[model samples]
Target: MGKHIKTIARPALQSTIKGCGCGECQTSCQSACKTSITVSNQVCLKESKQHR
Candidate 1:
């Protein structure tokens, strides 16, 4: 017997460059995210007041 595999849906690709600077993967993530984060070079970062 063959086993059934489950598939997971991942977030969509970045919609605009602006969203990228604001830390969003795509429109769907931006709309779903409750907290604000920044994304650069395809990395998600938190905006901090102090440079750390």
Candidate 2:
């Protein structure tokens, strides 16, 4: 019997942005990472700033 293995789907991030910005999921920037321990900045600063 084969061991159960679930593959996690990585978010589609832009080359310009690098990471997905969701600290819980994909790897993000230190300045923008939003975790329980620390909240230095926003989740998606690049996208928000770009749209605005």
Candidate 3:
């Protein structure tokens, strides 16, 4: 027997990148970038503010 693997759909990948969410949400142009690639949550272009 084989283990089942969960997966996200391709049509979902067809969606766009919204924001980096690093607290630099000043402008639409600043917060967004056109991407033909997928971004990993493990990496951030900017540091986020404290959650307090």
User: Candidate 1: lDDT over CA atoms?
Assistant: 0.42
Q: After superposition, how far is residue 20 of candidate 1 from its true place, in Å?
A: 2.3
- Residue-by-residue lDDT tens digits, candidate 1, 1-52: 2268555755555543453465343433333355434333333443332345
Of 2 and 3, the candidate ahead on lDDT is: 2
What is the alpha-carbon lDDT for the whole of candidate 2?
A: 0.49
Q: Report lDDT per candidate.
A: 0.42, 0.49, 0.40
Worst 10 residues of 2 by lDDT: 33-42
Q: Compared to the true structure, candidate 2 yields what TM-score?
A: 0.24
Per-candidate RMSD, Å: 13.7, 9.4, 9.3
Off by over 4 Å in 1: 1-5, 22-42, 47-52
Give the lDDT ranking, best first.
Answer: 2, 1, 3
Cα lDDT for residue 31, model 2?
Answer: 47
Write the residue-wise lDDT of candidate 3 on 1-52 in tens digits: 2268555543543333564445553332323454323334333335334332
> Which model scores highest in TM-score?
2
List the candidates' TM-scores in order: 0.20, 0.24, 0.16
* Candidate 2 residue-wise lDDT at 6: 60
- As a whole number from 0 to 100, the lDDT of residue 15 in candidate 3 is 36
